[model samples]
Target: MTQQPAADPFPPPSAPPAQQFAVPPPSPSGRWQPERVDPLPGTEFGLVQLRVMPITSGLAIGSLIAGIGSILVSFLVLCFGITGADSGWGGWVSGAFTLLSVVFGAGAVVLGLVARRQIRRSGHTGQVRFTGGGMAISGLVCGCAGAGIALLSLALALVLQVSS
Candidate 1:
């Protein structure tokens, strides 16, 4: 009889071999050709957008800082003068600071209003409006507070003078 070769247990599938893919020839510059990439749906790509800072931003910040500085100086002078720690110089220093505070406060208020007007005219693009508007409003509030404190101090000084 015979030991016939064992019948192949599992036959291979009869699928066709995969075809080879074709690649484009390299360019004269020896670089691979650039391929176009599709952006994700509902997204934008390409040129970068630039925005201009609002004109009033500088003015507002300047006024706010000046107002705050004036307030601090005036407060220190008032305190030192009252406690007799500053002698006569305190009065002069306080007067100077009070004047500065009032000037800065008025500047801040004016700049804030101008900034608002500019924003309205510019038609709201990017973050310019937000930043400029916020700075302007904050400056206005800070300046008003500083001016009020200075004015109060001035009144108090006048009263003290009258009483003395």
Candidate 2:
């Protein structure tokens, strides 16, 4: 025995054929209407545009690292008194390390300035959303402090020599 197709269980008594299952009209703007902006090539979805963006600053990071390292080195020199005048050879070694710290600090400040300049340029071009300007500035501050400390140490050394 073959089974026949079943009719609607509860069809409206006076409903017209076309209006029986009518779909609502589309709105003026469709649900997923994309903006009028032109889509970038190779993208199937026009909702988002892709572009290369710059963010990280290598120079700024280097500056921060160098500046902090210089401070740490100087602090170690002070803590250990590795350059104590008592030891003839230790004094020269300590002075050299202190000088190195000063140089590192200066380099950090210079690199930080360069990074900041690049960040500013990138910002103007709208290529970078965020920048490491704070890091660069902080590095500059540390560098100056390190240089100042070194100069003070040198001055004290000279004063002690004159006193003796």
Candidate 3:
């Protein structure tokens, strides 16, 4: 019996190897590297971008520093013996405390605004470092605000303490 070789089962491959060409890297978008960070890697899809500004970190740091400053100023006033309007030294103490409050309060406010700007510019999505920085800044701003509030509270407490 004549046995024909069993037909080959696999379908023929479609494309030849000669047609493939390596793809070049895309041009810079100007966000990550304005000039040059480093040479491009051989692989694709894992490059990180750095932003001009980060918002959250700013707020965090600013708030904290300012808040502490505010608290310190209030404490200084108390330490200096601020009292009812009867002494010249008391007026100086009050003025110094108020100045500290203003500086801390203003720093917090400015930092908060900066944080918001960074968030907006970066489109709200970024590397962990960038986000963390923004968050730290924000925390600082809040801390400052808290310090200012604490200063006010301390003023009241001091008055009560003196009265009692």
Candidate 4:
């Protein structure tokens, strides 16, 4: 005798399927493309928005460079003077380094002050604000310190020279 097929427990629905989110097809190069998604209500996404960065003042950067150079050269002057090396150019080299340190220190102070003023003015004008206020202040401090060191070193050298 032939057996009859078992009755189906679950049958396909007659109604059409619900609508789904549309997705773009892959590119011809077989790379997956990113889908554009709308941000949720009342939410802001930085990636979808243009951002502006504040500009750094050039004078502030220059001040920082000069200040660091002054400090470094001041140390070299101190080392050369303290070592008491009797090389032919020892005194001249030390004097030159000391002079360079003072010059760099002066430049740093001037540039830092100018940069600070420019940054303040720009901030008050409601335009793009300039950054690096801290750098300018630091440069000023470093420049003053370097200049003081050079002056002290020169005084010591002079006193020692006179005593001998």
Measured against the true structure, the TM-scores of the candidates, in listed sequence, are 0.52, 0.60, 0.43, 0.62
Model 4 quality (TM-score): 0.62
User: How are the candidates ranked when ordered by TM-score, highest leading?
Assistant: 4, 2, 1, 3
lDDT of 4: 0.74
Residue pairs clashing in model 1 are none
Candidate 3 segments exceeding 4 Å error: 1-60, 81-88, 123-129, 132-164
- Candidate achieving the largest TM-score: 4
Error of 2 at 36 (Å): 9.0
Residue range with the least summed lDDT across 10 consecutive positions in model 4 = 43-52
Model 2 stretches astray by more than 4 angstroms: 1-36, 39-54, 79-83, 124-126, 158-164
lDDT of 2 by residue, 1-164 (tens): 99999998997556234432233334475542222334334433233322334577888888888888778767754533434544434445457777888888899889989988888777432244447889998888888777676656655544444444
| Whole-model lDDT values for every prediction | 0.59, 0.65, 0.53, 0.74
Model 1: worst 10 consecutive residues (lDDT sum): 16-25
TM-score winner between candidates 3 and 4 = 4
The TM-score obtained by model 2 is 0.60
Task: Give the per-residue lDDT of model 1 (tens digit) for 1-164.
Answer: 88889888898646432221122335586533423233333333322233434455565566567656656655754664454322434455566667877887787777777766665666354444434677767767877887888777766654554454
Query: Which candidate has the top score in lDDT?
Result: 4
> How do the residues 79-151 of candidate 4 rate in per-residue lDDT, one tens digit apiece?
7766654443445667888899999999999999999998888743225679999999989988988988987
Q: Which stretches of candidate 4 lie over 4 Å from their true place?
A: 1-52, 85-90, 124-126
Q: Please give the RMSD of candidate 1 to the true structure.
A: 16.0
